[model samples]
Target: MAERVVPEGQRRRRRPTKQGAVLSERLIIDTALRLVTQHGADALSVRRLGTALGADPSSLYRYFRNTDDLLLRLADEFIGLAQEGFTPSGDWRADLRDMGLRIHGVYVENPQVALLAAHRTTGRAHETAAVEKILGILRGAGFPDPTAVRLYHAFVDQALAFAALDAAAQALPTPAREADEEVWLSSYGRLPPDTHPNVAATFPLLAADMRDSGYPFALDLMLEAAEARLRG
Candidate 1:
């Protein structure tokens, strides 16, 4: 009698491992995320993930084709988290702002995941749904297809880019992160008044603002530009 050969990424039946833990795609992704969060992105590997799951490393291929596939799924999972419970208020500016903030907040919360997945295009379910929702919002607000797509591209890319940048800072070692936070005060704030007139004059404001993520301001600027285009 011949044994069965399971094809990659097409295994339909969930099975329990030797340790009695049932393996599922969501469970695998969640475990992967936990590993990345606790041990950094370098912790994401076949051996580590299998050990963490207490399953055979080959079992993961049932859900994802490879490490890269798992990564895309993880990226889409972050998108799912961002879009979870989100409802469009029908006001284009407000909706865009809300969505932008949500993306930034979620990514920042999962800094390791953001650091790994922010720049990758995950054409998975959640990513597709988000794209659809944003485009629908823009089109519903009177923008034509081309304009809507352009706006959606800019909006999403800007959000992801800023989120990744902030996440990188957050992912730094504690001392390094603290040092970065103090730069506005220790370096920029203490610049010679005559040598750096503008910075010296605005150091107080910079000190206050530099402590926060700049995503909100950047989001608003993009929304404002979109609003202007819509108006004209």
Candidate 2:
């Protein structure tokens, strides 16, 4: 089967398997991404990836220097996904909010990758572009150069931090997640008012709140605060 690849300059020739299938860097990364998507974070081992690709595990080294290298590739793809369909409206606040949510969207959709490397730096091409786009958004909004850079730093870190935390929660095994939900519904919701009046009063809303992620609300609060700085 033929695959389309945008060649990285001076990269090695595509490696071929005994079955006559060809593998390129994009193919390897795409296969690994599918493996992570089908299984969870636990499915990213080199052996399993090699098995899925129908190649010897050692052959994967031709594309990636190691498992960490593979992860960087995956993370870069995720960064690219975060900006998919993004267009910068002249309204910077709305634009930034959309960007934040989209970045979080990718992480939530691919919790395994978020859990593995959301907070790690890839320094790969896509990641570099993502950074440049964010900084450009901030600068275009009329912030001073220093403020723009500082804001960009905090903005990205906050987005990734929340994404990672939310992804970890989302990635929990079903049994464990159910157990936590049970605690919320039964244990905490049933707290004795004399011993825990505050929790008792808030339990209903808290339990309801636990049904959905808080990333969107948290993102709003962050953006609101950032906008406040701009107004000052």
How many residue pairs in model 2 have overlapping backbones?
0
Backbone clashes under 3 angstroms, per model: 0, 0
Pick by TM-score: which candidate is best? 1
How would you encode candidate 1's per-residue C-alpha lDDT over 26-143 as one tens digit per residue? Answer: 7888899999999988888988999988887877766776788888899998998999989999898999899999988999998999999999998889999999898989999999
Superposed model 1: Cα runs more than 4 Å off: 1-15
lDDT of 1: 0.88
| Candidate 1 lDDT for residue 114 | 95
lDDT of 2: 0.82
Kindly report which residue pairs in candidate 1 clash with one another. none
- Per-model lDDT: 0.88, 0.82
Q: Pick by lDDT: which candidate is best?
A: 1
List the candidate 2 regions with Cα displacement exceeding 4 Å: 1-20, 39-42
